[model samples]
Target chain A: MTPATPRRRGRPSRTESADTPAARDRILAAAREEFSERGYDKTSVRGIAKAAGVDSALVHHYFGTKEQVFEAAITLSFAPAMEAPRTVEEGPLDGVGERLTRFIFGVWENPATRKPLLAIVRSAVNNEAAAAVFRRIIVTQVLRRIADRLDVPDAELRAELAAAQLVGIAMLRYVIKVEPLASADPEQIIKRVAPVVQAHLTGPGL
Target chain B: MTPATPRRRGRPSRTESADTPAARDRILAAAREEFSERGYDKTSVRGIAKAAGVDSALVHHYFGTKEQVFEAAITLSFAPAMEAPRTVEEGPLDGVGERLTRFIFGVWENPATRKPLLAIVRSAVNNEAAAAVFRRIIVTQVLRRIADRLDVPDAELRAELAAAQLVGIAMLRYVIKVEPLASADPEQIIKRVAPVVQAHLTGPGL
Candidate 1:
C-alpha cells in the first residue's frame, strides 16, 4: 500500500491487516531503513510508521517503543550471528575458540549479513541509545551464554574479553576497512585471531 | 574577527595573521568541532572556515583539504596516544605487550583524551573518507612503527592483530559502553588484555 493511503479510524483487531505477518515485516524493514539512514537519535516512531504506510498506533501496538523497534530490527539483523551461543554449546571447550571465531567470521564473510551488521555498528558507535540497545542484546544473547557455559574464574570478564577481540577485528577489517587486516585472507585472520580468543576464554592468568 | 569580515584586499604574506599559530590553531579547533558535530560526510571546509571566522581559503592554505584538516585534527587529538610506538621500543620484547597496553589504556583512561577519541571513532565508523584518513594516520604513525620493531613473520598482520584487540575493547568500553566490560576496573582489564596483546605481537603459531 502507498504511504498516502489513510489508516482506518478504528484499531484493528489481531486478525486485521495491521497484525498480519506481511505487515509486520513491512514495518520492520522500514524501521531498519530509517535506523540505517537517519540513525537512532533522529528516527522517530511516527516516521517509521509513515514509511511503512501504517498508523503510529500500529507501530506502538506491535513494537511498544522506538527502542523496542530498534531491538527487534537488530535482533533480526543479528539472527545469523545469534547462533553463536549455540555454537559454543556444540563444541568442546578446548575448540570453542575456533568454533566461535569461525562462526562469527563466517557470518561476517557473507556480504548479505555484513551489510546490516555494518548498519548496526554505525548506529551503535554514534548514539548512546543505540549502543545501549546493542549492548543489551549482545551481552544478554551472546556473551552471557558463552560465559555461563564456561566454568572458570572471571567467566563473565573472560567471555567479554573474547568478544572484544572479535569485535575489534570486525571494526578494523569490516567497518574501518584497515589494510592487511581488511584484505587479508579470511582463513589467515581466523588462524591468527582464534588463538588470542582461545587464550582469553580458557588460558590461565598471565 | 567575525565571519562578516571581508577578506583583506589580497593574500596576506607568510608573516600575517593567517599564517600565525593562533589562527592555525583556531582553524583546527573549529575543524574538530565541526567534524565531531556534523561528521565527515556532512562537514565542509567552508563551514569550518565560517566557524573559525576565517575565509575558506585560509583553511586550505593552512591544511590543504577537508581530509587534510581531519588528519591534522585527529593527529592533534591522538597526540597522547601517539607515544604508543615509542612505548613499544622502550621495553624488552617480552614486556612490550604490558607496556603498550598500559600506555594505550593510560591515554584512554583520561577524559580529556577520551572525548576527542570518541569523536574520531564516531566519524571514522560513519564515513569512508574519515575512515581512510584515520587508517592512514594510524597505520603510518602507530601500527607501522610497532610492526617495524617486531622482527616476526607477517609482522604487519601481527601488529594489526594486536591493534585490533585494543581497538575492540575501546569501542566496547568507551563508545558502546557495554556493561561489565564498561564498568570493570581499568587495571583489571589491562591485566587480562595485555597478555593477549603480547601473544598477538610475539607469540608463536596457534
Candidate 2:
C-alpha cells in the first residue's frame, strides 16, 4: 500500500455527510409520523429509517436505540418547557400568569411547536415511556424552575396546579379537538383562562 | 326430538341470564376493567367474558357486540351527565354554576364514578369509537342541555367553554396525575375552581 495513497471509505457515493443536523431533523420528522400513526409499540427503527430516507444503520448511529429515539422526540417536543423558565425570568413576576398564558398559547398555536406537542400528548396518553419522559421534563425543567422562582409557600404545588390547568386546556383544545374549544379564538381563551392560571401561580390561599 | 323433550329455556341458566340487571352490571364492570387495562383496541369479548367469569355467548346475549358492550360501559360510566340536567334544572339559574361545580366534583371524586370515568377517558384518547361516544354524550346530554338553559347568544360556545375548563382540570388531576392538582383536597379545589367554572357557565360577556 502506498503511504501517499488516500484511502476511500466503502460505499461513498451519493449524499454521504458526517451526520448533519438536517439528517437528524429528517429522522425526527419521520419518527414523529411513525409514532403518531402507528404508535410506539408498533413503530420500528427500520420503518422510521425507510420513512426518513436514511440508512437503518445511520438511525442507530445517531439515536443509539429506539428508546433513545423516542426520548429525543419527546425532548424535542418539550423544548418550549425548557425555555419557559428563562422567558418567565425575563418577565414581570406580578403578571406571571398573563405572561405564562401568552407564552403557552403562542408556542402551542405555532405549527412547529404544535405538531411535536400533539405527538407528546398522544404518546403520553398511550406510552408509559413517553409519560415518564413528560413527567421528568415537567417536574425537573418546567415546574422546578417556576417553583424555585416563586416566593410563596407551597410554590411547587401552585406551579404544578397552574401547569395542570394550562396543560389541560391545551389537551382539550388541541389534542382531543373538543369542538367549540378547538374552534375558540386564542385571544378569547387567553382572556378567560389567564386569570385562573395567574391565581394558581401567585394568588393567595392554599 | 328436542321439542318432544321440551327443552327448558325460560329464564336460561343463572350464568347465561341476560334480563337481570346484575348480569348487565357484571358484564359492564368487566368491560370497564378490560377496556381500562387493555384499551379499546386490545379488549375483546372473550377477554371481557374471561374477566367476568362468564361465557362469550352470555356476553353476546347481554350485549349484541363489542361496540354494544362498550356503549353499555360508557353509558354506565356517563350516567351522571344525564342526571346533571335534572339536578341543574332543580336549582335556580344563578346558582347553576355552584351546583354544577359541586356535582362535577362529587362525581369525579367518587370511586364509583371515577373508575368508569377513567375508563371512558382512556378509551376516548386511544380509540375512535370511544371518542365518538364521548363526543355524542357531551354534545347531546351535557352541553346541549346546558346551552339550552343559557340566554347567551353563544350559549353553545359558552357551554363548550365551560366543559373544556372543567374537563381539562379533570384530565390533569385524574389522568395525568400532575402533582399538587392531583393531590389537592377536593374542598380546596372546589372553593378556588368553582368560581372560575361559574364564570364560564354564567358570567357576564360572551
Candidate 3:
C-alpha cells in the first residue's frame, strides 16, 4: 500500500514531489487508485493529481498520459517477470516453460504486488485503454522479448500462446477465484502447466 | 442478436412464460443485459425481472437464483462449444488442440454469441459469483469431459493446462483485446497454438 516510509514526508508534499522518484511514486499511487476506481477511460491526469495532492502539471511531469500512468502503475509491480525473457535466452530451453509458469504464478501468489496487478487485470477486461496498456506490457516487455530469444518459426505466436494460458489460469485462480483452481495446490498447477509452456517454448512445429 | 423468429409474441406476454421456452428466453436475454451492464454482484433478480417484464418469481422459477441465471446467461451462448469435449473423445486426438482452439475461437468470432460472451468475460473478471458459474461450466461441462476422454496420466490436469492456455488467449485476444494477438489472423493463431495444445493433450509426462 504505502510505497515506503515517506522519504520526504508522510504525504506527497510539493517539495516531496520535486524529489523526482517520490513524486513519481505518489503520482503512480494516485494513478492506481483512480484507475481502479474509475478505470482507464474515466481516469485522468487531473483526477490522479488531485488524489495524489499534486498539481495536474506535476502528474503529467511524472507520467505522460493516463495510459502511461497506468502502464507504469501496473507494471511497476511486475518487476519479477521484467527479465523473464532471459529465462529463455540463457536457459537450456527445456525448463523455460516451467520457469515461465513458476515465475507468473509466483507473482500472483505474492502479496506485495498481486493487489495492484489484480486491479490492472480487472480494469483491463472492461476498458479498451486499460487493455491497451496491459497488452503493451505483456507483448513488448514479456512475450515479444521471449519470442525473440527463441530460434524457431512462429516464436512470437508460441510465446503469446504460452502467455495466454498463464493469463487464463491467473484469471480463474486469482481475479475470478474460481475453484478448484482457486484452491488447487500450486504444485498441481505447476506440474501440469510447465510442460505445456516448455512445448510452446521449444517444441516442434505445428 | 434476436434468436430466430419468435414463435410466441414480440414482447414477453405474461402468460407466454407458462409455455416455458419463451419465458426462459426472455429471462436469459434480461440476465445477459443486467449482468453485462451491472456485473454479477450488482445485478439482482428483481432487476432481471424488471428488464424481462416478468415477475421476479418467474425469474426464480426459470433460473433458480441470480447465480444460476448468470450461469445460464453465459453458458447459453457457449452452446456451440458444449459438444467440444466430445470432439476430443470421438476424433483423432492429435487434432484435438486445433479442434478445441477452432471451436472456442469460433464461438468468439461469431456475431450472435460474441457480444454476450464478451459481457460474461468482462463481468466475470471482477465478480465472484459470475466467476463461480463460469468455473462450474468450464470445469464440469467442458474440462472434466475432455479430461475423462483422455488416456493419459493426470488427464484432468493436462486438460486444464491446455484449457488455461486457451482461456488465457481468450482473456487477452477477446476480453482485453491485447495486440498482435487481438489483431493477428485466426488461422495464424490456430497454427501456432494447436501444436502446443496437442502436446498438452497426449505428449509425454513432464
In lDDT terms, which candidate is top? 1
* lDDT string, candidate 2, A45-97, tens digits: 98787777777888898898887888787777688757877766787888888
Q: What is the DockQ of each candidate?
A: 0.48, 0.24, 0.41
Q: What TM-scores does chain A show, candidate by candidate in order?
A: 0.89, 0.80, 0.84
Name the docking class for model 1: acceptable
Candidate with the greatest DockQ versus the true structure: 1
Highest-TM-score candidate: 1
The native-contact fractions of the candidates, in order shown, are 0.77, 0.38, 0.64
The better candidate by TM-score, 2 or 3, is 3
Off by over 4 Å in 1: A1-17, B1-19
lDDT of 2 at B66: 90
TM-score of chain A of 2: 0.80
**Which has the higher TM-score value, candidate number 1 or candidate number 2?**
1
Off by over 4 Å in 2: A1-31, A44-68, B1-34, B44-69, B85-87, B92-98
CA lDDT of A205 in candidate 1?
A: 62
Error of 3 at A175 (Å): 3.4
